[model samples]
Target: MINLTINGFEVEVEQGATILQAAEKIGIKIPTFCYDDRFKPHGSCRICVVEVEGARSLMTACCIPATDGMIVQTESEAVVEARREILDLILANHPLDCLTCEKAGRCTLQDLCYQYDIEETSYDGARKSYEKDVSNEFYTADQTKCILCGKCVYMCSQVQNTDALCFVDRGFETHVGTPFEQGISESTCVSCGNCVSVCPVGALMPKRREKYRYWEVDKVQTTCSYCGVGCQMELLVKDNKIMEVLPVTGHCNEGLLCVKGRFSFDFVSHSDRLQKPLIRKNGELTEASWDEAYNLITSKIKEIKESDGPDAVAGFSSARGLTEDNYLMTKMMRAAIGTNNVDHCARL
Candidate 1:
C-alpha cells in the first residue's frame, strides 16, 4: 500500500496505483478524458493535471504513480488555470455544435467544460476540419468535432485489438483516420462499436439518431442474451422503446462487445417478431391464448409419451434463452419426460 495526500486528505491505495485512482478512491472527482480502465493511461488530454509538493511542474494524475508521503493538490488555483488552458486549446479545435450533436448530454468533453465553467476558448486559430465519414453503416466519424484525445485510437488498438484507427500526419495537422486514408468501412473494422464507446466528444456517433436527451432516457442494466459470454449492456430506453445499446464496464466481457451484441438489437422491436404464441388453425398460423398453447403442448407430449415412448421425445433449447431457462428445459426433458434427448444451440 502507498499513502498519499490529495487535497489535504490522507488516503492509502494499492501499490502502483495512479494518483487519479487514489483521488477517486476518496470521493474526489478529477475530470479526465483520456483515462479509462481498459486502456493504458496516455495523458494526452492534460485535463487531469495536479500539483505536487517539491515537483518542478504540474503532473498528469492519470499516469503518475502515487508514492509514500507524497503531497498533492488536485484543485489549486494553478492547477485550475492549467486545466482551463488545456481545455481552451482543445475547444479551439473542437467545433461548437453541442446543441445538435448526438453526444450532447452524454459527452465527456461537454461535462468537463461545464464543470470547469469553460464558456469559450482563449486561443484562436485555424481549426482543423475534415469531411464527414458516414460510410460506416453503424456510426459516423466527423473529425471536426474530435479533440484528438487518442482514446478512440487506443481503444481500437489495445482494447479491441482491431487496430482499425490511427493518428494520421503530424502535430496540428494530425487526425484520426484509417490506413491509406480510406473510409472506416473499407478498413479491417468489424463494427464492434468500441471506438464509438470511448470517444469523449461527438466526433464518433451512431448513425441512428436517438430521439430523447440523455436525462430523458432510462438506462436499464441487463446481460446481453445473444451468446453464452454474458456480456453486460445498458439499454437506453425511452417511452418503452430501446433507443441505444451501451457496453457496461467491469462485467463478464469487461466493457467489450462483439458487433452482434452491440448492433443486432433491432430485431427485438421488429414487426415480424412474434409477440404471442401462435398455433396452426384452418391451415394458417393464428395467435392463441397462453392457456390454449400450454394445453395443446401438454396433450401432444402425453400422446407422444404413451404411443412412441419417452425415448422418442426430444427438445432443443435456443442459445438466446437465459441460462436458467435452458437449465429448466434440460431438466424437464430428462426428469419429467424421462428422456435425455435435450441440447442447446450454444453447445452446437
Candidate 2:
C-alpha cells in the first residue's frame, strides 16, 4: 500500500495506483478529458495536472503512481493556472458552437470548461478547419471539433479490435482519419458506434440527433433483442419513444456491441410494428384486444386437448419473450396441460 496526501486528506491505496485513483477513493473529483477506465493511461490532455511536494513541475494525476508519504495538491494555485492555460490552448482551436453542437448536453469538454469558470477563450489563435465527413451511416466525424484526445482511436483499435481509425498528419495538422483519408464507409468501419460512445467532444456524433436532451431521457436497463446472446443495453426513452440505445457493460457483451445492437433500433418505433394481438378470423388475420385474443386461444387449446387427448396439444414458445415467460409456458405444457411437447424458438 502507498499513502498519499491529496488536498490535505491522507489516504492509502494499493501499490502502483495512480494519484487520480487515490483522489477518487476519497470523493475528490478531478476533472479529466483523456482518462477512461478501459484504456491505458495516456496523459495527453494534461487536464488533471496536480502539484506534488517534491516534483519539478505539475504532474498528471491520471498517470502518476501514488508513492509513500507523497503530498499532492490537486487544487493549488500553480495547478489551477496550469489547468487554465491548458484549457485556453484547447479552446483556442475548439469551435464555440456549444449551443448547436449535438453533444452539447453531454460533452465532457464543455462541462470541464464550465467547472473551471472558462467562459471565453484566453488564447485567440488560428483554428484548424476541416469539413464534416458524413460518409459513415452511423456517425459523422467533424475534425474541426476534435481535440485529438485519441479516445476514439484507442477505442477502435484496442476495444473494438478494428484499426479503422488512426492519427493522420503531425502536430497541428493531426486528426483522426481512415487509411488514405478514405470515407468511413469505404474503410473497415463496422459502424458499431463504440467510437462515438468514448468521444469526449462533438468530434464524433450520431448522424441523426435525438429530439430530447440527455437528462430528459429515461434510461431503462434492458437486453438487446436482436439475437439470442441478449447483450445488455440502456434504452434512452423520452415521451414513450426510444431516443437511443447505449451499450451497457454487463452480461455476455462486456461493453461490446455489434453494429446491429447499436444502430438497428429504429424498428421499435416503426409504423408497421404490431401494437395489438393478431388472430386469424375467417381465414384472414385481424387485430384483436388482449381479452379477446386470450379467450380465443384458451378455447382453441381446450378443444384440442379434449378432442385428441392432452398429448396431442403442443406449444412453441418464442425467444422474444422473457426467461420467466418461457419457464411458465413449459410448466403449463408439462404440469397443467399434461404435454411434453414444449420448445423454444432459439432451441437453447
Candidate 3:
C-alpha cells in the first residue's frame, strides 16, 4: 500500500498504483487523454502531470508510480499551468470541428478543453492538412485532427494484435498510418474498430451511420447476437431505431468486440430487415401483433397435427438460438407433437 496526499487530501492506494489512479480513487479529477486501462501507460500526453513535493519538475500522474508519503498536488498552480500548456499545444493541431464531429459528445479532449475553459489555442502555426482517409468502410482516419496520443497505436498493436497502425513518418510529418502509405482497407487492418474505441479524439471514428449525437441516443445494454460468444454491447437507439453499437465490459468480451459486433449492426435498422410479424391476409402480407401471429401459428400447428399427424411437421432449429432453446424445440417435437422429426438448420 502507498499513502499519498493529493491536493491536501491523504489517500491510500495499493502498491504499484499510478498517481492518476490514486487521485481517481479519492474522487479527484485529473484530466488525461492518452490513459486507457486496456493498454500499457506510456504517458505520451502530459496533461495528467501533477506536482510532487521536492521533485524538480511536474511528473505525469498516469505512468508515475504513487510512492508512500509522497505529497502530490493534482491541481496546484504549477500543475494547472503545465496542463494548460499541453492542451494548448494539442489544440493547435486539432481541428475546431467539434460541432459536427462524430466523437464530439464522447471526446475526452473536448471535455478537457471545456474544463480548462480554453476556447482556442494560443499558437497560430501551420495546422496539419492531411487528406481524410475514408477508404476504410467502417471508419475514417482523420490525421489532421490527431494529437499523436498513441492510444490508437497501442490498441492496434497490443490489444487487437494486428500491428496494422503505426506512427508513420518522422517529427512534424509523423502520423498514424499503414505500411507504405496504403489505405487501412488495403493493409492488414481487420476493420475491428478497436483502435477507434480507444481513441480519445475524433482522429479515428466510425463513418457516420446515423445522424444523431451521443446524448440524443439512449444506450441499451444488450448481448451481441453475431455468434454464441455472447459478447456484451450497448445499442445506441435513437427514436426507437438503432443508431450505433458501443462495446460494453461484460464477462464474455471485456469491453472489446469483433468487426461484426461493432460495425455490422446496420442490419437492425436497415430497410430490408423484417421489423414485425407479417401475416398473409387477402393474398397480401400485412403487419400483425404478436398475439395474432402466435394464435395463427398455434391454430395451424394444431390443424396440421390432426390432419397429417406429427410426422408431417418437422422442426428445424436455428443456430442463432441458445442451446436450451434448440433443446426445447426438439423436446416439443418429440414429447408434445409426438414425433422425432427434429433437426438443426446447421446440419442442412
Superposed model 3: Cα runs more than 4 Å off: 278-316, 322-348
Q: Give the candidate order by descending TM-score.
A: 1, 2, 3
Stretches off by above 4 angstroms in model 1 are none
C-alpha displacement of 7 in model 2, angstroms?
A: 1.1
The digit string of per-residue lDDT tens for model 2 on 1-348 reads 878899999999999999999999999988888888787889999999999998999999999999999999999999988988888889999999987787888899899888778887877668899999999888899999999888888889887889899999998899889989886889899899989888899999876656667878899999888665778988888999888888899958888788888888888889998999999979999999999999998998899999999989889988767676788999999998999998888877
lDDT of 3: 0.88
Query: What's the lDDT for residue 139 in model 1?
Result: 87
Provide the TM-score for each candidate, comma-separated. 0.96, 0.88, 0.85
Clashing pairs in 3: none
lDDT leaderboard ranking: 1, 2, 3
C-alpha local distance difference test of each model:
0.89, 0.88, 0.88
lDDT of 1 by residue, 151-253 (tens): 9999999988989999999988999999998889899999999989888888988877456778889999999989766789999988888888899975588
